[model samples]
Target chain A: ATTRIFGQARFTCLILFYVLFYGTYLVSGALVFSALEAPIENQIRLDLIRAKQDFLVRHPDVLDDDLESLLDEVVRASNHGVSASRNVTGGPNWSFGQSLFFSSTVVTTIGYGHVTPLSQPGKLFCMIYALLGIPLTLVLLSALVERLLLPATALLRSLNAALGHLYRPFTIRLVHLTIIVTTFLVFFLVVPAGIFAYLEPEWDFLDSFYYCFISLTTVGLGDYIPGDSPGQPYRPFYKIATIFYLITGLTFLMLTLTVFYDIPQLNLSSVFSSIKLDED
Target chain B: ATTRIFGQARFTCLILFYVLFYGTYLVSGALVFSALEAPIENQIRLDLIRAKQDFLVRHPDVLDDDLESLLDEVVRASNHGVSASRNVTGGPNWSFGQSLFFSSTVVTTIGYGHVTPLSQPGKLFCMIYALLGIPLTLVLLSALVERLLLPATALLRSLNAALGHLYRPFTIRLVHLTIIVTTFLVFFLVVPAGIFAYLEPEWDFLDSFYYCFISLTTVGLGDYIPGDSPGQPYRPFYKIATIFYLITGLTFLMLTLTVFYDIPQLNLSSVFSSIKLDED
Candidate 1:
């Protein structure tokens, strides 16, 4: 009875902490985005309009017979191919903040851009390649979590054994989880975040931590992508580093999840019969 | 005890069915792609060499510009630019499949494949756009499932009520989920797939279902995007209808998830809270 009471209290506290964490980042990011919307919009709009005008002027007689003759010659030289652009399902012009938002959606796999993907090659690769990679990454992260959880689960079991007479299993597990999370933060979040800050040309320590937090959360807002930095040499190295950081960060996240998974009482996705699933 | 056995069987079946559905599509796509690879590569190589020789003869002085200037011009026309392609990631000479893959990545929001939104606008829009749409689709689907689940959940409850009083609440929920899923397939998959075949220009039933399945799963391999058929008119209607289909399909997915969510189960993500924090 005493242990059960303790377990309930621990669960409430953790839920409170998670709610607080999620609330802080989402609300703050929204506010920041709203604040900067105006300037970013202006910059993007100006560039886009200039490009559109230039395209139009350069191809002013685009519909004429002279263009037809040019098209025929180009087609003849290329052995008779047809044009494939401009039956596009276009929307209103997007702003800079909007573009960042779009990039985030794509990276996060939450693409809801009513706008269609134009161009044939662009459409085809988008399908199965992601299906292959996303699951691979998820499984790898889950595997790492399982590895990390070995020690934590052992510690949890020992704690349960030590306090068997006094405390409930639930209460013991909560303490174990808190300890594991702290360890993860120090090693995974704090340390690697520092290293990323060192490497990212544009981000300071604060910004790098922020980026790590956001990306690992699966938010994936693209305002701070690695390779886009101007004058950055070794673009591939920087890009590859970012990918490694993402995979690593995801592992720590799975570690947190494994702590949760340790409790048979809470697993929800356990569809396998040999495995007991808990309700998260 | 008998009820529990039945429930376990049901759960196993559901997981197996879902896995098989997804696995078959992916594995077959990969096999098809692998088989096509050699033939496609040869054809593409022949075309590429032909294009190169023809370009050399036609524009003999096209390479007269300095290398830096040429690179700069192409960079100016990257996909990140609003005027540039939205789905593609890289510069000129990218394969058709690469751009199609890019489109799938962007639209599905996997944003993997090591490439990313190049232009400022593309990035911003990617995030913001999903924010508005994904949740809306989720809400719609959850509502749909709620209607389907009520009777199903009640049926399980009544079945248990009639059976021995020895079974756990979890077993009842499992039976209910199975019924609901069957209903989902009949309505979401079979009926609508038949309708798509009838309405879409020149598409057979199998092709339509394949399209529906691919689009809903967000695999979007671009092998069969609608409205791309030559001589097709009223493209806007087709595009809009396709968009509606995506939104509606996504809603069903969310509805199924909500059922899972309501099961009060321990999903791995929430397993950490299995331990109550207070006693430790």
Candidate 2:
């Protein structure tokens, strides 16, 4: 009874700690993002204003209101992923290949939103598709992770056999986790990022790495989708490759997280939930 | 040994079935979206072209190429969520409130890319922020769900007692899940969507519902973010309200899923994994 009471107290403390930690993290992020991006945003806004003024100066016959209306149309169209500019290239956004990629992104919850469903039916269907697809994807990923854990378990067993006399179990498990993390970073993040950087015309190593990180985490801010550049060759194939890469990368990420959570001392979430479940 | 073999075969069959189902789902979605959206997309493309031609015809003294270049700049600026037009309203996208909304979305993994980081430092910081914040958000939600599940469990126990002589345990549990699901829809989906539709000037009921659904799923297609339309009153407060709504909605969603998976026979994913875990 005493231990249960102590456990409840600890749980309460942990929850309070987390709430404070999360608030601080979110506030600090907002402050940093506001500070770092606000200046650049202002600069971009000015540059745009200057560009419009230059256009007006260059074309003295064009009335300001006329140009403003045209710009309004252009902005409206662009917001829906339609480019009014002649310089813009690449096939339609709703082509089969692109739609396939879109479908994959939607079900996976990556949802780049570079091209969304404009039609009412499309939006309705999207909600329905996600309704079934999200759970299906979760089950598929979980089953795959279950299979993958076997080999990981075998690796741990081999490590235990070889290093039982040398190190403690927790230390050995830490080493095991380190190896998994290293392999995951190399294959999923670093190598794929290098390839993306090489293929994308504008992306540097950092941008590519950021894209990989954003994508695998499923944050998918959609600022830097691959294969969307103008006049790109084999756009469909490139998109398909990216879709495959995303799935594989996400699978490996789940595997790594599962392995990480297997270590009881390291799984902070389990620390919170385990006590409650035991109390039940 | 024979049962193990049978279990392996069943597992393989389940995997194959899911793979096929997922593939079919993706392909059909692609086809439907392509058919539904292609005509509208083509119409938009033509409209844009005709608009440009109309502008050129009206401003006969203006060079076509020069106007095209200006449009290119306009498109580029618009892609980064900046408006070159004087008619565009609302505050800058990177205001403190907007940044806080962005931060909340990122950690929750909703990641509405309506406003994203433009600077290299901003993008780098975003990646780092999401790295730590995602897990933190997960733990917080898990802890809250653990607390919420107590009342849910009590409800289930009451249902089981009342229906003990009348219905099977599964039926009682099913009733319990139905009540939970209806409550979730009313509070998180239907009511909140009504509120969003009432508040956002341009959004109809479907758009509002779609937005709520997309956001709660964390798919966050970014097509219809609220409080972003021009000249809105109390925009920051509205945005903060939306952030709170998303967090609460997501918590209830997790709670529903937990209650759903609690019923052993209803959980399809567990069927695939429980046998394997038992073999181990």
Give candidate 1's TM-score: 0.44
Worst 10 residues of 2 chain B by lDDT: B271-280
Candidate lDDT values, in order: 0.46, 0.89
Candidate that scores best on lDDT: 2
Score candidate 2 by TM-score against the native.
Answer: 0.95
lDDT of 2 at A213: 93
Give one digit per residue, the lDDT tens place, for model 1 in A158-258. 89889877888788887787887787678776887787777776577666665565456554433354444445566545544555566566677667776
The reply for model 2, stretches above 4 Å from the true place, is A1-17, A274-280, B1-17, B274-280
Task: List the lowest-lDDT window of 10 residues for candidate 2 chain A.
Answer: A271-280
lDDT of 2 by residue, B172-235 (tens): 9999999999999999999999999999888999999999999999999899999988888999
Q: Which regions of candidate 1 fall more than 4 Å away from where they truly are?
A: A1-147, A153-251, A258-280, B1-56, B60-78, B81-148, B155-183, B189-251, B254-280
| Number of the top-ranking candidate, with TM-score as the measure | 2
